[model samples]
Target: MEFSNRTRTGTHDSHRTEHDATRPGPMEEAAAVMRCIVCGHRAGYNRAVVDLATGSEVGGLCVGCECTAFGVSLLFGFRLSGSNCAFCERDGHYAIPSWRARTVETGGKTVSTVEYDVTEVTVRLCDEHLERLKRVAAAHARVPGSVRPSGPE
Candidate 1:
């Protein structure tokens, strides 16, 4: 999301007014950072949102909780506490990262660009929903032309 600030001046009193049209101000960001996603504890920057799958630099882990094994638990997948399942609102048991590539029309020809996007809000999924998503992803991968973008003719 983009944000811009607007300022207006009044001639009568020569007063300047400033207004911010963006949501989630600094206070909100700070509050979000303070809240722990795993144990619902307010430990400020001590807690992190860790990825259970690859154990990559997804986020942080709670210092108080027993989930301090950052990037060490591959067999038992776990996501941040506050994060819910993408498919369902249930507690997120696993964190999955999705990647895709596409072709864009540049000038008169189509150019393939490696577009990568990671979800800011972790995609937490329950066991049942995770299995379903895996199956769907597998099916799509098997289909030819499904993964590629339909560029300009």
Candidate 2:
């Protein structure tokens, strides 16, 4: 059976079905017909990833959304050159850096230093994904014992 991008109203569990070598599997067919979550574009060519955490398909990621959803993750000394989202492999639009800060006693005085922990990491986020990421980060920040001390007493 041929599949097309259509808004399925009722709840349906996307299942996989085996097919002959000449035909595509059920999962493959579903992916081809999936629509983008942000733009509602028919993602026949630009298939998005499935959010395992939420058990739903995500589609139509613009550069901003792709960047926000994936973000970048690189070593401290590395450089970024690509415009792809690190998490979703979509085009990225931003380069956001994450830092790690530490405070230490220097010459009997307290001094603070910041390290670019995610030096190569870039931030590319769409409006939706950016807002979602920010919300999640804020939630984590509010949790007790979520942030750990960098130095020992």
Candidate 3:
């Protein structure tokens, strides 16, 4: 499931504003340092070589010489399929996708350079789990006009 920010109209000195000053930003983040798929180097993709999506600079081949060689052939939005359900080991009937903010550290462990990315995680679900998920989602969603829970087909 995806989440969107909600804004409420406010009056300041009888003037309307879209920016909410009272909204506090996240004070802490839960993150993990995942290595690039192309190279085992901790900070390889955008640091050692250019990112195909974003044209930075391909200075040279990465520590793992196979980065560009194999990376170039992969499609832009690649994902794994034919997997079991995320909740259980059953043939997946539907794809469930969620997105989150991610940061990739570059310039090696010595430097503090960072690149931002919106990472998407997709999981497959079996029919039984999917129905349960739908019911739970509907129950949790109190706002009207949201995706209503589906009935039996």
Candidate 4:
């Protein structure tokens, strides 16, 4: 599903406030229809899906609040899960490949976008996790000169 740029409106887990400055806006309707990568559950009310970069809620299966969080943990290992570096946070994914390759439009003013490669890799993860990440990256590969996520004006 395509991501949405609109702010989210709904109740969330006690710890997850929709207004948190760190969380991105809510998932668009399209994203809400996606099945959880971890639990295979369709996103329902209050699922814990979030942007993989930050563990903030994006959208997830309504049946369980953990689908979004779990899916990201599986794709990108969590610090507390004791998962290996293959799934752990890394520096590569957070780097913007090149300076000329990014841009941003903020407050009606255009600016250079932040480029980062936040994925981490370690030796201990199983091959299955690595393969999963590769597939994920392949699917999300953006077109050259495509804007990174912030929507049109």
Candidate 5:
């Protein structure tokens, strides 16, 4: 199945109020189908993978939930799971959705769109690599022109 950065409703553990500040995509349909086993937000999720905690396998998580709730970003909207690391043979711990964006001229205005890379992979990473990648992503977000996730606008 395909895994995208779409959020679903219905949470699993978190009691915090629902927050869907970002934009929505085609995965909106998934929100009605599955709920997050962690936050219980009743948002969208991935049905292709299994939820290691309950083994329900119905839905996984969205990109925002993956970051705020789990601290592990998703890669191309995919919820990372499995056993081994994509970089090394060691066990995996974290996943990042290494998304790309670019501003283009559309209708005489600049529009930014999230784009995917050709080599994007939904592989897990060890703590060592995940930490490093998180650090780099953080640093990159600090740079000017970088798109960083902000609170509800």
Candidate 6:
């Protein structure tokens, strides 16, 4: 979500406040590193290089049991179609990197450098998956509305 600091005069004192929009934030981008929405398990993943070949899943089981269940939902085409992280398989959690292609003029020559920027996307979990996430989170001491748990488990 887009956040902006707003300053307004309220009667006597000038107040500065932060306003959040309906948008994805940096935490979502970082969390997309390889988290399973169904169970909140995170692991390293090797991304698929070509579309023709199916990706490989070799990581250990996630903390949540419903991850496998979610996989079943995805298998029969029951999932609502949308793009998700290739690793975590959760939509909106991953931030698609944007490549900036441009050139700058040097003292006497032209130099080009590609810049990469990561933008987070808001992914919507299916109802069942969301509920499972909530239960798993609660079990792990994670609070609702707060994505990160308060302390080390």
TM-score of predicted structure 2? 0.28
Residue 3 of candidate 3: its Cα lDDT? 17
Each prediction's whole-model lDDT (CA): 0.39, 0.38, 0.34, 0.33, 0.42, 0.32
Give the per-residue lDDT digits (tens) of candidate 5, residues 1-153: 223542222222222225542435333343445553333345333322332233234333434444543344343344434566666877654333333444556555444444222122555557666555446554654568854344322
Residue range 27-107, candidate 3, lDDT tens digits: 111111323222322432232222323333223222232222224322354444445565677865544232223433343
153 in model 4: Cα distance from truth in Å?
A: 32
lDDT of 3 at 37: 26
Candidate 3 collision pairs = none
Model 3 lDDT, full chain set: 0.34
Please identify model 3 stretches exceeding 4 Å from their true place.
Answer: 1-82, 98-121, 143-153
**Model 1 lDDT vs. the true structure?**
0.39
Error (Å) of candidate 3 at residue 153 is 25
lDDT of 2 by residue, 1-153 (tens): 111222322221233234343465443464446553443344332323333234243453333333333433222333444545444566543333432344555555444433222122333333345456546544544668754222211
Shift in Å, residue 145, candidate 5: 1.8
Per-model TM-score, in order, reads: 0.29, 0.28, 0.26, 0.22, 0.33, 0.22
Tens-digit lDDT string for candidate 4 (52-138)? 444334333332323222344533433332223344554211110110123345555433322212222212224355346435433
Report the alpha-carbon TM-score of model 6 versus the true structure: 0.22
| Structure candidate 6, residue pairs in collision | 1-23, 1-24, 92-123
Residue 35 lDDT, candidate 3, scale 0-100: 33
RMSD of 3: 19.8
Model 1 steric clash pairs: 37-81, 37-82, 38-81, 48-60, 48-61, 49-60
- Which runs of model 5 end up more than 4 angstroms from their true locations? 1-82, 95-122
By summed lDDT, the worst window of 10 consecutive residues in model 2 runs over: 1-10
Backbone collisions counted per model: 6, 9, 0, 21, 20, 3
Minimum summed lDDT over a 10-residue window in model 1 is located at 1-10
